[model samples]
Target: MTALTLQNAIARTEAGRARAAELAVAMNIAIVDAGGHLLHFSRMDDAELGTVDIAIKKARTAALFRRPSAAIGEDSQPGGPLYNIESTNGGLVSFGGGLPITDEGGRTIGAVGVSGGTVPQDVTVAEACLT
Candidate 1:
């Protein structure tokens, strides 16, 4: 199976971080490999320290599940088998603003995460960088 190179992961993560900062998001950004391993991270100076763990959790959840964490939250609705799935992983965040990064061929390669801004603001930053 093909994998996302570490270099690309770092580049994308940094790009996302920069975009967020440029937007005055004051955020923390993180990238995780396909296997949910952290590949890169950047926390803006104005961001809260607590955002660090939230960003990592978002990246890990997206990478490990190969989907956006917001989708995971959707799947975890009441009466759904995935309900409360977040409880299974102490470091997983099933919230919005986390998205999986896919390869050119449309296969999941990794994930990018952002925190410290509003959920939509974080999503906007991530989308801006990826697009």
Candidate 2:
């Protein structure tokens, strides 16, 4: 399988940034390979400092789990099967905004994460990124 290339990562980041701009929100975007290694990152001019790490962790969470991070969050709620899963994989951001990037064959190739906005906004931008 082809690996996640810099060009692919940059395209996703740019798409995400455009979505954030359209939403009138500054955001930080993180793109990671299938193995959860960061490949490309973007911090919009006014994005919060705290969002940098949060964005990266979100991408890592999605990449590691091969699903949207929010799915993990839902399953990890109190008394759920994956309770406390956020404490694993060096700290995961199990909230909305992280989504696995899958190829046409349905293989998870990477992930995109967006932060520096509300959960819904972040999720929207991430969705646009993968559009």
lDDT by residue (tens digit), candidate 1, 58-128: 88898888888898988788888688898876767888878988888888778888898989888876675
lDDT per residue, candidate 2, 24-108, as tens digits?
A: 9999999999999989999999889999999999999999999999999998999999999999889999899999999888899
Q: Candidate 2 at residue 104, lDDT?
A: 88
lDDT of 2 at 83: 96
The TM-score leader among the candidates is: 2
TM-score for every candidate vs. truth? 0.87, 0.97
Show the colliding residue pairs in model 2: none
lDDT over C-alpha atoms for residue 120 of model 1: 88
Residue runs of model 2 more than 4 Å from their true location after superposition: none
Best by the lDDT measure: 2
Query: What lDDT score belongs to each candidate, Candidate 1 first?
Result: 0.81, 0.93
Q: Model 1: clashing residue pairs?
A: none
